[model samples]
Target: MSAFDGVKVAVLLFVAAIAQVSIFGQLHVFGAVPDILLVTLVAISLLRGSVAGAVGGFFAGLIVDTASLGTLGLTSLVLTLSGFWIGRYGETTGRDRAHAPYLSIAVVTVLYELGLLVVHFVLGESAPAGAVVRSLLPAVVLNLIVTGPVYGLVRRLLRAMERQELSAEVQLLG
Candidate 1:
């Protein structure tokens, strides 16, 4: 990625982190808040690559942790994993798939929640697995619902980078 591309992604993640904490944090639909940051991170990972995803995840997660005043590094770990795996998925099989965004959102939403629960349990924190599971469906639905718009916007924003990456990959294959 170019320096400009990196800057663009940083700005995007920063805006997403802010929106997530300030706006979506307060909006509860069906007893579940939509994870705009996660969805945005997924979009970035799918568009960029594993390294970009992991880095963006860590940066965004740190911003979120600071903004929400939650346990530092907790979100960073989870998001970094999510971003790397999803970016790998994109690099291998998901980039050309139309359902990639929706599928990624659904699957990651489930895993993200469970991962958080597991981490909390490990940390001896209150890990309400039952409540998290109960709310899982709604959160997944909410995330999937927003996937279309978010992915589209992200793709559009990163169109130039996508073209560059594709050409580079094609040359490598050739």
Candidate 2:
């Protein structure tokens, strides 16, 4: 990707990170909050590629970690994995599929939460199994709800920007 594309990804992730921490993180519904950052990362990764997705995930996780003042690399690790695999999925199978975004969001939501629990357990933190189980369904549903609009917007933004760049390149070459 172009440097401009990287910058755009960064800005987009930055906005999503801020919104996730400041807004979505606080807006708990049915014992779960919508993970705007995760959904955004998934959308971008799907549009871009695995490398971009992994990089975006790492930085976005860092932003969340620093913003929330929680464990530093925790979110990064999860997001990195989510971003990489999701991007690979996009690259391989899901990119053209109509239900890719929804399926990706749902599957990743579950894996992300489970990964969180595992990490917490490994870290000797109070990993509440009951709470995780109880909130799993709601979180999945909330994430699915978020995945649609966010994915559409991200897809539109990337395509428009890329199209503009392509046309500019063509003009210059002509």
Estimate, for each residue in 63-84, the C-alpha lDDT of model 2 and write its tens digit. 9999999999999999999999
lDDT of each: 0.94, 0.94
| Per-model TM-score on C-alpha atoms | 0.93, 0.93
Pairs that collide, model 1 = none
Q: Give the TM-score of candidate 2.
A: 0.93
Per-residue lDDT for 29 in model 1? 85
RMSD to the hidden true structure, all candidates: 2.2, 2.1
- Stretches off by above 4 angstroms in model 2 are 164-174
In candidate 2, what residue range of length 10 has the lowest lDDT sum? 156-165
